[model samples]
Target: MMLWITIKVALRSLWANRMRSILAMLGIIIGVGAVIFVLSLVAAAKADMMGRITAMGTNLLVVSPGQRGTGGVMSGTQQNLTADDAEALLAKIPQIRDLAPVVRGNVQAKRLAKNSRTSLMGTTVTYFPIRSFEVEKGRLFNDADCDAMSRVAVIGATTATNLFGTEEPCNQVIKLNSINFRVIGVLKSKGDQGWFNPDDQVLVPYTVAMKQIVGVDHLNEIDIRANNEADLDTIMDRATKLLRKRHHLQEDQDNDFSIRNQAEMLKTADSMNQVLALLAGGIASISLLVGGIGIMNIMLVTVTERTREIGVRKAIGAKNGDILRQFLIEAVVMSGSGGAIGVLSGFVLAAILSRVTSLQASVSLFSVALGLGFSMGVGVFFGFYPASRAARLDPIEALRYE
Candidate 1:
C-alpha cells in the first residue's frame, strides 16, 4: 500500500512537469536505440559470414603460393603451384580424399548480342564436390575433357543470365576472349560471399585454361578435401612435406606455399567480428553514460524545485526513507519509460536497415533485456545523490523558506 502511494506521488510529480520529464528521457531513448542498432547489425553480419563459411564444405583446406623475396626485398606471389603438384599430394597423402588445381583469369564473355566481363576459373571435375558446387543444368565437364584440354566451359548462374539472358546456355557456344567455347553446364546459384560472388564467374578445365585461356602453367590455388575432419591437420603436414620435397626446398628454407584450413579461417573471422562488435558497442555506450548524467542533472533540479513540497510532506510526519523512495521512483519511471520507447525504436530501425540495405539485422531478446536493464541501472545510480540530498533537508529550514 505504501509502495503504491509512493508510485502515485512520483507519477503525479512527473505529470506536473511533463515537458521537463520528456526532455530528460530523450537522451536515454537515443542512447539505448543506438546500442541496440549497432549490436544487432554486427550479429547479423557474423551470422552471414558463418553461413558462407559452412557452405564452402567441411574438412576443407586451401593451398596458395607464398610471397617471393630477393635478397631481403619482397616480391609478388611465387607462381610455383602446378597441376603436377596437385597430383603429387593426391598420390602421397593418404588423408586427402580429393584435390583440385585452380587457375583463374579475367575475360570478356560474349554470346549473341550480350557480353559480360567476369572471372574464369580453370579447375578439374573434382572441383565441384570439393567446393560443394552443384551443376543445375546440363552436365559438368569430365576428367577426359580436362586431360584432352577441351574448350568446354561451365557458367555460373549469374554468368549464364548475364551473357544469355533467358536463353538456355547449355550446349551454346560462348566466346571467351575471342576463343570459342561450348557451355556444357550452368552452375546453381551460390550467392555472394562478402565481395566475392561465386555466381559471377565461369568454370573450365584447368588444362584448357592453362593452355589457351590464362596461358600459364602455374596454378593460382589448390583446393584439398580431407577424408575426415580429424585428418585435416595430418593432411596439411603431409601436403607440406610432399610439396617441399617436390619443390626441392633445402632444410633451412621457408615454405614456398601457404596452407589454410577452413575451420581455422572461420574461427579467425568470428573472432574479428566479435572485436568489431565490442568496439562499436563501446562507442555507442558513451551516449548511455551521457544520458545517465542528464538524469542526474535533471533530478538535482527536480529536488530543488520541489523543496517546499518536501517540507510540507515532512511537516505531515513523513520519514526520510519515504521522501527518498518517492523521488527515486520518479527517476526510475522516467528512464524505464524511455527504455521501452528506445527498444521499440531499435526494432523499427533494424527492420528498416534490413529492407533498405544488404545488411541483415536481427534483434535478439538478450539485447532488448540488456538495454532496458542498463537504462534502469543508470536511473538508480544517478538518482541516488539527489534523492539523498532531498531527504537530508532540515524540515524547519525548508518550511521557513517562501
Candidate 2:
C-alpha cells in the first residue's frame, strides 16, 4: 500500500510539472543514447576487422624488416630483407611450410590509351597458397615463370577492371615501367584489409620485378605460413635464431627483422578496440553524471517549492520515511523513464549510422541493460541528499514558510 501511494504521488507530481520533468530527464536521455550508439558502432567495426584478419589464415606470419607500432610508427631503420633471407629461412627452418618475399612498388599501368596507377607486388608462386588466394581466371605462375624471370603478370580483380574494362585480361599485354607483360591470371577479390586494398594490385614473379622492373634485389616484407598454428612458437624461435645468426647479432641486441603472427595482430587489434570502447564509455558517462547533478538541482528546487506540502503530510500521520520515499521515487521515475527513451532512440541512431557511415555497429544487450541500470543508480545516488533534506525539515518552519 505504501509503495502504491509513493508511485501515485510520483506520477501526480511529474504530471503536474510535465515541462520541468521532461527537462530533468533530457540529460539522461542524451547520455544513454550516446553510449549505445557509439559502443555498437565500435564493436561492429572491431568484429569486422577481426573477420578480415582471420580470413587471411591463422597459421600465417608476417616478417617485416623493421618494427611497426600501433600508429604506423617505425621503431627501427629499414633493413634490407632480401630474397636470400626467404630462401635461407625456407631451407634452414624445417618447420616452415612455405614463404614469399614481397617486393612492392607503385607504377603507372597502361593498356591502350587508358592509364591507371596500381600497386605492383613481386612475389613467388608459393605466395598464393600461403596467403590463401585463389585465381579466379587463368593460372598462377609455374617454376619456369619465376626461373626465366618471364614478363608475365597476374592482376587483381579491381586492377583488371580499371585497366581492361570488362574484357578478359588473360594473355593480354599491359605496359608497366615501359615493359610489356602478358596477363597470365586474374586473382579473386580480397577486398580491403587495414590500410591497403589487396584487389587494387598487380602481381608478378619476384625475379621479374627485381631484375626487369623495380631493379632492386631487396624485399619490403616476407610472408610465411607455418606448418601449423600449434608449431608457431617453435617456428618463430627457430626463424629468429637463424636470422640473428645470419645478421650476426648478439642475444640482447634489438632484432633487425620483426616477426608478427596472425594471433598477435588480432590481439593487438582487440586491445586497441577495447581501449577505444572504454574511452568512449568514459566520455559518455560524464554526460550522465552531469544529468545526475541536474536531477539533484531540480529535486532541491522541488523541496523548496513544496515546503508546505511536506509539512502538511507530516502533520497528517506521514512519517519521515514516507516523504523521503516520495522524492526518491520521483527521481528514479525521471531517470528510468529517460533511460528507456534513450534506449529506443539509440537503436534508431545506430541503424542510421550503419547505413550512412563506414563504422559497423552491433548492439549488445548487455550494454543496453548496463546503461539503464547506471541511470537508475545515478538517480538514487544524486537524489539521496535532497530527499533527506526535505524529510528532516522542521514541521513548524516548513508550514510557516511564505
Candidate 3:
C-alpha cells in the first residue's frame, strides 16, 4: 500500500543521513540506559534488604527496651523486659507461636593465642527456630543447658574460623570473657549483612549470659513469632497492651518497651525503595526529553532539505497524510532503534556494576518494558510538530523554495 511506500521512503531518507540519525538518537540511548541501570540497581538492593530482614524471621515482632518515666520526669531507656514478661506473653497471647528472650553483649573470644572481640547472643533453644538459625556442625544447646546454666556455646562460622582455624570447633573449649565454655555447635554462614554479621556471633543460654557474661538480670530484647502473617497486627496490639498492664504504667506514662513487626518493616522498606527509585529515575529521564528535542530539530531540518521532494510528490497526487506519516515514521525508527541499543547497554552496565561494586543490580522485565515504552513515546510526541508542518506546506511555495 502507499503507507508501506512511505515507510520505505522514510527509511531511505534516514539511511542517507545515517550519522545525523545516530547522533539524534544518542540522547535517547543514554537516557533509557541510565533509567534502566538506576532502576535495576534499586530493585536489586530492595530485594537484598528485604531478604535479609525476612531471614531474621517471618511474622516476627520484636520487643526492645524503651524509655520510662521516673517521678513524673522522662528517663533514658530502661531494661523493662524479662523472662517472666516473655512467659506471660506466650501464656496470655494465643496468637504467639513462639517467643525468645534475648540478651547480647560484646565479648573477647580466645583459643590458644587467637582472640577476637565478637557479639554474644544469649537465648533459649527456641531462638533458633524463631530466627531461622540452623546448625551446620554438631548440635544446638537444649533446654537442659539453659536450666542447668551450662557453659555450652554455639559458635558462628566466622567465629569458628577466627578462634580455631582449620581445627574442629565443636567440642573445643574457648574462653569467653575469661571463662571456659565448650563449643556445642557451629552455625551455618549467613554472610556479612552490612549492619551486623550474624555469622560472627556466639550463642549461649540466656540464664548463663545474664548471671555470668552480661551480668544483667533484665533481657535486652524479646523476639516473638505470630501464629501466622494475618495475626501480626493483632498480636502486636495485644502484646503492647499486656506489657503495659504488666508494668503497671498509668495512662499518662509511657510503657518501658517498644514493639515492631515484620509487616511494618516491609512497608517502610517499600516506601524507602520507592522514594529512591523516583529520585534516581527522575534525574536520568531528563535526558529522554533532551533526546526528543534533538529528534524534533533533526526532523525540522529534514523537512527543509526535502521541501522540493515534498512538492514534487504533492503535485503527483501524494496526499498531506502521506507526507506526515513518512516523516513521523522516520523519527520513530530512529528513536526505536536507539531504545533497543540502549536496553542492551543498560543490561551490560547493570551486570558490570553488580560485579565490580558493592551494589547488587538486576535488570527486571518491567524496567525493559518501561524503557522501551518511554523511548517510543518520545518518538511520536516530538516528531509530531515537524510532521504536521511538512503536511501543511503549500505545494507551490515548497516548489518555489528550491
Candidate 4:
C-alpha cells in the first residue's frame, strides 16, 4: 500500500509540472545520446581495421627489417632484410607455404599518349598467393620470368585504366624510366584501402627491380604465408633464427628483424576501440551527473511549495518512508524517461554518422541498456538527500509556513 501511494504521488506531481519534468530529463537524454554515438562510431572503425587486416590473408605474416615497437613502421633503424633472407626462410621454414621479398620505389610510366605516375614494386610470383591477390584479366609473373630477370610487367586495375584509357593493355609496351617493357598481365580490382590503393601499383620481378629500378640488393619487407594458421609460431621462430644466423648476430644482441601475425593486429585494434569507448563514456557520465543535480534542485523547490501538504499527510498518520519514496520515484521517472529518449536519439545520430563518414556505424543493444541504467542510478544517487530532507520536516513548522 505504501509503495502504491508513493507511485501515485510521484505520477501526480510530475503531471502537475510537466514542462519542468521534461527539462530535468533532457540533460540525461543528451548524456546517454553522446555515449551511444561515440561508442558505436569507435566500434565501427575498429571493425573496419580488423576486416582489412584479415582480408590480407588468414595465415599471413609480415616480416620487416626491425622489431615492432610503439613508433610504427619507421620505429626501428635496422635495414637488414634482403632477398637471401626470403630464400633462407623458404628453404628452412617447412611450415611456410609461400613467400615474397618485396622491393618498392616510386616511378613514372607512359604508354603511347597516356602517362601516369604509380608505385613500382618488385617481388616473386608467389607474392600473388601470399598476399591473397587475384588476377583480374592477365597472368602474374612465373618462376622463369623471375629467373631470367625479364623486362615484363603486370599492372594493377587503377594503373591500367590511368595509363591505357579504354585500350586493351595486354601485350602492349609501356615505358618505365625510358626503358621498354611488355604489359603481360593486369591485377583484378581491389578497392581503395584507407592508406593506399593496391590497384594503383605496377609489379615487376624482384630481380628487375633490384637491377634496373632501385639498384639496391636489400628488400623493403618480406611477406610470408604459412600452410596453416597453427604453424605461424613455429614458422616465425625458424625464420627469425635463420635471419639472425645469416647476419652473424651475438646471442645477447636484440633481433634486427620483426615478425607480425594476425593476433597482434587484432589485439591492438581492440585496445584502441576500448580506449575510445571509455573516453566517450566518461564524457557522457558528466552529463548524467549534471542531470541528476537538476533533479535534486527541482525536488528541493517542490518540497518548499508542498510543505503544507506534507504536514497534513504527516498529521494524518502518513510515514516518513512514504514521503521519501514519493520524491525518489519522481526523480527516477524523470531520468528513466530521459534515458529512453537519449537512446533513440543516439540511434538516429549513428545513422547520420554512417552516411557522412567512411566509418561503419552499428548500434549495439548493450549501449542502450547501459545508458538507461546509468541515468536511473544517477537519479537515485542525487535524489536521496533531497527526498530524505523532505521526509524529515517537522509537521508543526511545515503547517505554520506562510
Per-model lDDT? 0.88, 0.86, 0.89, 0.86
> In angstroms, how far off is 210's CA in candidate 2?
3.9
> Model 2: clashing residue pairs?
none
Candidate 1 local accuracy as lDDT? 0.88
Better of 2 and 4 by TM-score: 2
Q: Which ten residues in a row have the lowest lDDT in candidate 2?
A: 68-77
Which candidate do you rate higher for lDDT, 3 or 4?
3
The clash count of every prediction, one per candidate, is 0, 0, 0, 1
Please provide, for model 4 over 1-402, each residue's C-alpha lDDT reduced to its tens digit, 9 standing for 90 to 100: 866766676777777888988887778989999988888888888888788778888898888877545545655546678888888888888899988999999878988877888999999898987776888777889989999999899999999999988889998999988889899999988667655789999999999988998888888889999999899999888888888899899998778878888898788778878988889978898888888888888878888888988888889987899778877887787777788889989999999989988778988988888998998898788889888988999999988877
Residue pairs that clash (backbone atoms under 3 angstroms), model 3:
none
Cα lDDT tens digits for candidate 2, 73-192: 767646568889889999988888999989888888999987989999999988888877899999998778999989899999999999989999999999998899999999999867
Displacement of the residue 56 alpha carbon in candidate 3, Å: 6.0
Error of 2 at 361 (Å): 4.4
Give per-residue CA lDDT, model 1, range 1-402, as digits (tens). Answer: 977887787777777878887788888888888878878887888888887787777789999998899677879999999889999899888888999999989989998778999999999999999888999999999999998989999999999999988888899999999999999999999777765889999899999999998899899999999989999989988889999999999999999999999878888888888898888678657877788888889999988888988899899998899889877887887787778778889999999999987778988999899889989888888889999999998898878766
- Per-residue C-alpha lDDT of model 3 across residues 98-185, encoded as one tens digit per residue: 9999999999999989999999999999999888889999999998999999999999999999998899998999999999999999
**TM-scores of the candidates in the order shown:** 0.82, 0.82, 0.73, 0.78
